[model samples]
Target: MFELKSVSKTFQLPNKDSLQVLQNLSLTVNKGEIFGLIGLSGAGKSTALRTFNLLEKPDSGHVYFQNKEIHGGQIDQLRLVRQKIGMIFQHFNLISNKTVEENVALPLKIAGWKPALIQARVLECLKLVHLENKNHSYPNQLSGGQKQRVAIARAIANHPDLLLADEPTSALDPITKIEILDCLTEINKKFGLTIIIATHEMNIVRRLCDRVAILDQGQIQEILPVARGEIHPQTKLGKMLLEIT
Candidate 1:
């Protein structure tokens, strides 16, 4: 459902030199698949993910959603396309001033959903993330896991076809991490959401993703399937991940 073709991104420094972040990065994500993008810090994993939402524009090449190119020139088209894609960050970007319900409903409200529809959708989304009873709570009152749940609820409230999760489990305790992973798994299964998760945590990828890609220095080093009986014979990242577990 999503494709990146020879996409590259660079940042200009004050000294006039450029830091190339993404170099001819290309990949495809299909419907009903959890594609894991794993790499060390500064490996361009986050930059590559940002290109999907045009949060970071590619310096060259194209990003296609369902075969349609997404770029800066097509703001209206990009907006409509982005409605089908949702994103969640490592830090739960919740508004401290808004109640949990309000936070989740904000996206729908911005999309111009009617009051009744937004209310119903917000409740439904909270229920999916198992946070239905906390609607009246504020972000300050929630735990790390609860905050992440609220973020997930907000991301999915629009019924997006694709969900981009950038280190969703990074800040949680081990037990909480498992719970959040389970919640994400449930969403993928129940809603057929295509998930592209950028994370350093291999355990989450092993448990959740159908296929995994290891990125290093703005390039994909390997792509492997996640199955107990399947062995990735050639990829260093896959072998390393398997040996660690």
Candidate 2:
């Protein structure tokens, strides 16, 4: 449902130098699939994710969502298209002032839903993430896992077709990470949400994704299916991640 065609992005440095962050990075994510984008830092994994929603515009390529090219200056079209796409950050971007329910309900509010409908959707989303009891709590009162769950709830509040998760498990402990991954897996299966996650954690990919892409220096090096026995100690990215974990 998402496609990036011949996408390239570059930035001009202060020293009159040019840095290419993404180079002809073409990728297609199918519906109801959890696709993993894996790479070390500075490999353009985050950049590629940003391009999906036009957070970062490609210099010379096209980004298509459900066959419609997304370009800047189309505010109404962007908003309509973006409602189908949701993004979660490494840091839980919950509003410090808003309660969990309110935070989750924010999108529905923006979408102009009535109060009763918003309340119902927020409750369902919180329950889906196993955070039903914490709806009245604030972000500061919750654990890291709870906070991330809140973020996930908010992201899916609109029933988005695609979810872009950037390093969703990077800030959590092992057990919490597992819980969060389980929540994502459940969401994918239950809602058939197309998910594209950018992460350095092979375990996350192994546990959740159906297909994986290895990126380096702004280019995709390899894209493979998630195999049981093939995720061995010899794979470079897998090995590094295992060592770190």
Candidate 3:
């Protein structure tokens, strides 16, 4: 579904220093599969995820979506590409003033959907996230898990083909994290949505990912299959993650 070839990104520090977040990172995400990008805090997992939709333009290399290069394109074309890609973050990026339904409808409205269709789709997405009853609730009124569910609902409201989750469950408690993962799993099965989750949590990877790429210091250390029940990680960081859970 997506591919990154020799992608690299660097940030200019305040004191004239340069921090390379991604160094020649390359990977491919297959359609209908849940892929995991696993690493430590400064491993560039989030930066790499942002490159999927050009949220963080890479300093070098290429990003491809459905076999077409997506970098340096027309603004309209990039906007259209973004519509097909949904993203969720650790902090639920909801408009506190808007109700759950409105928050979910925001993207559809921006995409210029008709009122009737937006209403129907919003309800459908909320129901999928088990938040149908919480439509009238505000973000401040909901718990962390519920808020994340609302974010999920909003993300899928546009019927995106790929979902990018960056530390999605990091802020939640253990039980709530499981709930969110389960919700994502259900979405993947029901819609065959391709998911790329950037997280440091091994439990999340073990429970949800089909394959995982272990990254360290802005580089991809290894990519391993996770669906077969046993994962033999070779890198030091990967081994540590396996031992964590």
User: TM-score for all predictions?
Assistant: 0.94, 0.93, 0.98
Q: Show where candidate 2 strays beyond 4 Å.
A: 14-16, 229-245
RMSD (Cα, Å) of model 1? 1.7
What is the TM-score (0 to 1) of candidate 3? 0.98
Which is superior by lDDT, 1 or 3? 3
Number of the predicted model whose lDDT against the real structure is largest: 3
Q: How many backbone clashes does candidate 2 have?
A: 0
The digit string of per-residue lDDT tens for model 3 on 1-245 reads: 69999999999999999999999989999999999999999999999999999999999999998888996557888898898899999998899999999999999998889998988899999999998999999999999999999999999889898899999999999999999999999999999999999999888898999999999989999999996556889888899999986
RMSD to the native, candidate 2? 2.1
Largest TM-score belongs to which candidate? 3
Candidate 1 lDDT over residue span 97-120, tens digit each: 999999999889877788988988
RMSD of every candidate to native, in Å, equals: 1.7, 2.1, 1.0
Which lDDT values do the candidates have, in the order given? Answer: 0.88, 0.89, 0.93
